[model samples]
Target chain A: MTSPSNSSREAIAHIAFDDLVALLEAIFVKAGTAPGVAAILARNCASAERDGSKSHGLFRVPGYLSTLASGWVDGKAEPVVEDVAAAFVRVDARNGFAQPALAAGTPLLLEKVKACGIALLAVRQSHHFGALWPDVEPFARQGFVALSFVNSFACVVPIGGSKPVYGTNPIAFAAPRAGGDPIVFDQAASALANGDVRIAAREGRSLPPGSGVDRTGAPTTDPKAILDGGALLPFGGYKGAALAMMVEILAAALTGGQFSFEVDWSAHPGAETPKTGQLLIVIDPDAGAGRSFVDRVETLVGRIADAGQERLPGDRRYALRRRAAEIGIPIAPALLKELSALAGAPTD
Target chain B: MTSPSNSSREAIAHIAFDDLVALLEAIFVKAGTAPGVAAILARNCASAERDGSKSHGLFRVPGYLSTLASGWVDGKAEPVVEDVAAAFVRVDARNGFAQPALAAGTPLLLEKVKACGIALLAVRQSHHFGALWPDVEPFARQGFVALSFVNSFACVVPIGGSKPVYGTNPIAFAAPRAGGDPIVFDQAASALANGDVRIAAREGRSLPPGSGVDRTGAPTTDPKAILDGGALLPFGGYKGAALAMMVEILAAALTGGQFSFEVDWSAHPGAETPKTGQLLIVIDPDAGAGRSFVDRVETLVGRIADAGQERLPGDRRYALRRRAAEIGIPIAPALLKELSALAGAPTD
Candidate 1:
């Protein structure tokens, strides 16, 4: 048997993308999520795993199960889509996951974009615990330029502020190109993502300088300190802080969702998700001034390569995705066993 | 005479905002711009001066005149607006100033936004040499949220690249508030604005570390070197670079204008402006999910204050504008004389 282990020390298990999605779907359904929600989330999480977004992939399964078990998120809640205007679509997630809300509203959002050349999707009362690129990449694949913003629970401090008032808010953008995969990026305004800090704490690793401050408001590199009532700093200081604030406005305030600071989950123990809001803007490049949008994107990509920038934003993900297609997605044996147990499958 | 001299030594002359606009208008007309173009440019420049954006105010007059003299820009070119879709408007600036193009398209853009809940304006073949806040702030005052992006001449490098592939692309956002001035922020993707680097070079001052790299691609603090042949780093490493790239795509590729790296003014020695593109998106907050958009903004503002943030993004500009309104715009006697000479007025 040709084992797919790339590392020398540990033997790894390899599973096809579809199989992984099926397993995750079973796990979610077992955890009481609606079948539709499970399918959407399973695909999203499996795509992340295939693309090497480890932080948002299988690592998030335990959190999702815990939050679902805690009754903090209504996995069976059906999203209510509202056709607000010619270019606006609002979705009430009804405390469900943001992905399902987005999925439910996407058809209407696309119709609006088709009619108006651009459209806005505002999703409120949602829990967004996945990588944001998944929320936008499909639009790019459909030949639309998409930008999305999502605000999470408060874990980041404003500039010159001692208290946490902003989440590790993320901004994601996706645009199509002529010859290759879409250019996509999902970045958090914080110096380090909350998930990354948690991973570091779990691994007994230290964070980079300027990542966060301790509870006493003193800068520290210890990940545990940052997780223990401490707050993350915005990347690039004030500019990043401004982007974070903008995310709050666009996601929470505009969507009629709770602000990052307003997210109070004390009533539900084991809740790991932040019930917040998300905003997505989709634009049709055919309505733009450019003669050929994808051709122009190709030109830019060539220029960037000529400039000696070896990697574009989504290049790594595309590479990993291709590798995953060629050989099944690599997973550790322990993780695979855990996932099998969650799915009620026999583990070898 | 009760001169508005905030400084001890210099005898600063005080002029009302209207007077300053008139002076700038005269100067633009003397420099060969159409009366309409001059009017719009004058108000934009005057507003910058009133709001303490000195780099984009009178300090930009020489560059404008120089570019005009080089015959690199058409000062009198009329903007042509096209209503492309229900929510998309395009403007061909015909190599003229971007302000006039935006002015010409604003009516249709507003109409579309009102009807469609959101609208996009694309301006191509334009020169945007002024501050970006002016482009978005007015929309906020009109009960809309606005976001704008403009890419300039290439002066920033992509990460891991030695060549300059991106400009000091700036993104500006404006939103209405319930009880105060609009919340606005205009920030460049680079570590510092090109104007600030020029100012530092003029003052023989060193820049902060990580600002830019010298000619050989080594990090340096000398603004002169950065101006000479070096390139600026993005604000927050790869994140800022990604934004800069996105701006190029949105403002140039999407708008059918020249990319920053494609800007070639070598034949026009005195040319200073980048004949690029701009993109603006305006949304009607009343069409959003929120009950009251402005009230939501007020809530965020109050929370920010409570979070110990002593100042917001646009607070300083509002304070400066108020002071200017009360005491008139203060200008150095020498600079005032220069402006008067350019306007063909008698200098005392």
Candidate 2:
């Protein structure tokens, strides 16, 4: 009946946490990223799962590896400064990935301020940085405030109109919290975070609906149709449309890179990856007044987190990391087997 | 009927925008804003009309005056250097109006960035700064890229969840465009911009149905019901929700200010004035290795703008501004009469 229905056979694979991390770290390092960058990037990818961003998690192993394998995403490319001025900094990714580009850029930013106490950096020609949290988290951990954004494929349309011309462009910000993990935030400006929808459709699952529009601009739950000709609807319509536009201009426009339609990472899937860039900003609290600024800012965050059930954006992920460390990650058994075979190891 | 419909009987009052600016400049000077700040702020508020944001234009005068009158938003207060340390600047607005705070903070950020060449300035305890574009355009005009965001009263809920927990926060970014005005972007995170909705409702027009949901979550085109108990729907929905959350956390969370339900603009008709804050990031082009960067950026923008009747983002406003100069400022007879009273002048 119905060719043994794709629904009943659908099952999620739960691979062990350590197994996934090891595989990621090994592949990333083998691909050419410096051990330090590799470790941090892997850690960040693992961290994505903790935040329930599984689509951006280690499941991206094949995709990322392919980028390195094809030499489109230079695993060992070191970022270099492309432009610098009184109030701006642009970094050339040199075709390297985003993590190292950001890492290289952050320190340069710190250096500029040592002169005048402020700097702005636009990082271009870089690949995705997995989750933006890690990009900002370090600064927060160091008691600094940071903001960042990156452009992906353009699948969203302008407000009050149709015609897909903007990317899901994600934006992020982080702030230091005393005696706690820095508050980290990362978000995409798509109704269903395209990634989740992609993953769901790949798994033969039906979306909760209202996430996208099918061809002809009607509300839809059928993910495949939505993905085909029906473009993604903006988050709050015009507001969402405006934001998607803002991100496109900010992340790409400011960087003097691909802005509107050129950002098609082939939907961040395999083959012919797109060229994208990033913008990272760092704020040194001491520059505003000095002395107890960090502590004071931390106090503010603490008060908010303590005020009620309130917690910072990355709190849930931090909690999940703790749980993963305690109870082991819960990847599907089938996924574990495949990863194991890919690693030339067998699942226990 | 209905006390003689004010709108239909209203006449159009024509006045040179310069005259209106002069009047506003005088009022602000009298209110104690620095001459420069007052002039600039007035210019910006007036420019909002030129940009088609009438709600933030002269319409906001009474509320701004009320804030000045109440002392919640100080006219005489200046920004205080609350903190600073390499690539970061934090300003305590000291309860000052937002324009001056932004004015004071923008240059400080530009000056501080030395090596990394990126700086973030977190500003707190500030009032509205008319249009976010004006606030950021200066940096781009100076060949520096800038991105800014402002959080207002909470106006939206997270995706898949009910109840308003975040505001329809607005975000903006300005990028240099060689010889052209910087490519400016500004937007909120709701189905329809709140101001647009308000203007539509005020004009006795109906929303294009599906713009918002009624109190019971049923879709309706009535802006009144949507504003009252019905909620604003997100663009592309969940994406919109995530975006609102992103803006709130960045604009409010990182600044040691209010966030989510904590935002309350007293003038917004339903809640207290939010403990608002703004995030200003400026990136100087020369902070890196390129010189023709501005021209390069323009090439890309030009290519897109030339693509079949696609005027750049802020072009219409500028065009309108130029045309309106000759046509004269067209204010409703009702509003003109009300504002004419500001100078103790005759209503006719």
Candidate 3:
């Protein structure tokens, strides 16, 4: 199925899940990534599509290639996990993609969590260009509560400040359920995520009030002004700013990686692999509190649902994932052509 | 110094730090609390006053005594700390006051955190009548990052719903700084704390827009509408609601205590000791990372300060504490008289 574009751009095309993953794998393999790393990266990109996050799907392949071409990211680098303590795992990502690094260390970290009741995975020198949920949702599926934080290149201003001092630091959390799916949520500390505002600016649409500031720090609803020189405001004034600081400390300081202010962002937009840090925490609910934990969670969830407040965190993503699995993932025809060219294949 | 009331109300009184603590202790003892529990409870009350949180200070004493009088709380109950896991301490409060329960468990939790890199202190069946910061600040002072969440009587509506389905759940966090006071903050998930809105309604003052809704589920700025029949709105819309759910799960579900909706709030104003749950997490930064943690935190804090955002999370509390310690705490004359009567003493 395809929808013609109003502009001269190519129409959208629907692609099967396996086909999308295979195409992405070919692209990264051609771009000098090891076959295994390419497979992991492809799965991460395909999952973003499956979960309806088009911004992080195959559209981002060009940016990943840009970072790989510039040597800012080591395509074949392997992550190393060291047990710094009984309940801590330090993962040096070796300047590679964060998804693969986390994929490598999660099982090891979960083992420690089961043994110690709680565990922390401190990931350093990784480039996290994907959504935060993918890194933490796996543990929740395996009957554990997981929370993660990551610090990116500086884009958001601190409260009562004009300049960008912190990244649009995001936090993700997931809690396991007894029989149903786990509850999971991921949110940036800013009023809107950077990519979202950029999409608004690209579509020539203005933003809601309090979204960001103009170059002179005057509040503006123009998304272009924010994307250009201004900074995104924190989500809930001082409260969200405090959370951003918490993310900075937990993801950067505790992970022993570069802080947001320490990053040197480019004048022009090109994904040079912001060498960032992330921290993930996992707790075995069975170990921490036993069977009573899941029962209690189900009780609260039932109350929330019975009250007709069923749109809990991560509900939208879950719905979209089911829809995408039944149907196929939608990608623009121009994007498919670009991927095919990158993989050295003719257009379908 | 006191301000004369327009209605011929009693003027305020200034009580010395030690005198305030002694007065509270006598009242708790008269209310049938054990000597040691009374001492701990009194210090908790005095510290609230010392930090200028007058709402939680002597103002809450009547509620505590009422709970004790009603036999809803076991005034002399001693908390038992059980080593639930390698990194978890489960404190059964024996249906007693939370301050004493926390007092009994803090050292044990801190020791586990120092050894395990992170530890969780779960308090169950405790009446947490005071502020949450006090429960976490001690560990921060001892060079640990502490976070605490407590679920209270239901007063706040979940986002998109008109009824009170959740507590004005408060979460507190503190991160230690080298040679400086810890950065600390405590915030209620509701748009405003329940007591704060009640004080406003008592004073016949209007509230900010979007604070709460009237009985019919229509948004209203009238404080009385909210205090009487309406429900407080969650802070920052759905984000605050998610945080509230996080607190409910962490403090209640994980701690094996009652959720907010499960509480039967009293019809009268006096507190009947809502047996709630609280979760405290402490992490030794030195154990997690190294010396680099402090330096990185300072770097980020300095940037925040340089941007004129120096009024960090805990600065106001720290300032109030220094001033109160040097001078004395201010109390309303009416409240002091009431407290004196409860303690079987004449006015000072």
Worst 10-residue lDDT window for candidate 2 chain A reads A1-10
DockQ of each model against the real complex? Answer: 0.85, 0.29, 0.58
DockQ of 3: 0.58
Range of the 10 consecutive residues with the lowest summed lDDT in candidate 1 chain B = B1-10
Task: For candidate 2, give the lDDT of residue B217.
Answer: 57
Model 2 lDDT tens row, A117-232: 54457777777748777777877777666777787765665543345666677778776655677767777766667777788789888776546766666677888877888767
Q: What is the lDDT of residue A141 in candidate 3?
A: 87
Model 2 chain B worst lDDT window (10 residues): B1-10
Per-residue lDDT for A70 in model 1? 94
User: For model 1, what is the alpha-carbon lDDT of residue B244?
Assistant: 97
The interface RMSD value for candidate 2 stands at 5.4
lDDT of 3 by residue, A1-348 (tens): 333434556555677778888888999999989888899889888988888777777667778888888777888989988777777788888888888888888878877888778888888888888888888788888888888999988777888888887888988889987757788888888888877888898999999887898777778899999978998988877888888889888888888878887776464245556787999988776654533788888888888876557587887878888876776777777777778888888766
| Model 3 pairs in collision | none
Residue pairs with colliding backbones in model 1 are none
Best model number under DockQ:
1
After superposition, which runs of candidate 1 have C-alpha atoms over 4 Å from their true positions? A1-9, B1-9
B1-348: candidate 3 lDDT, tens digit per residue = 223333445554567788888989999999899999999989988999889777788778878888888777888998998887778788889889888888888888877887888888888888888988888788778778888999987777776676777888988988877647888888888888778788898898999887898877678899999977788888777888888888888888888778988876464344556687888877777755644677778888898877657588878878988876666676677777777888899666
- CAPRI-style grade of the A/B interface in model 2: acceptable
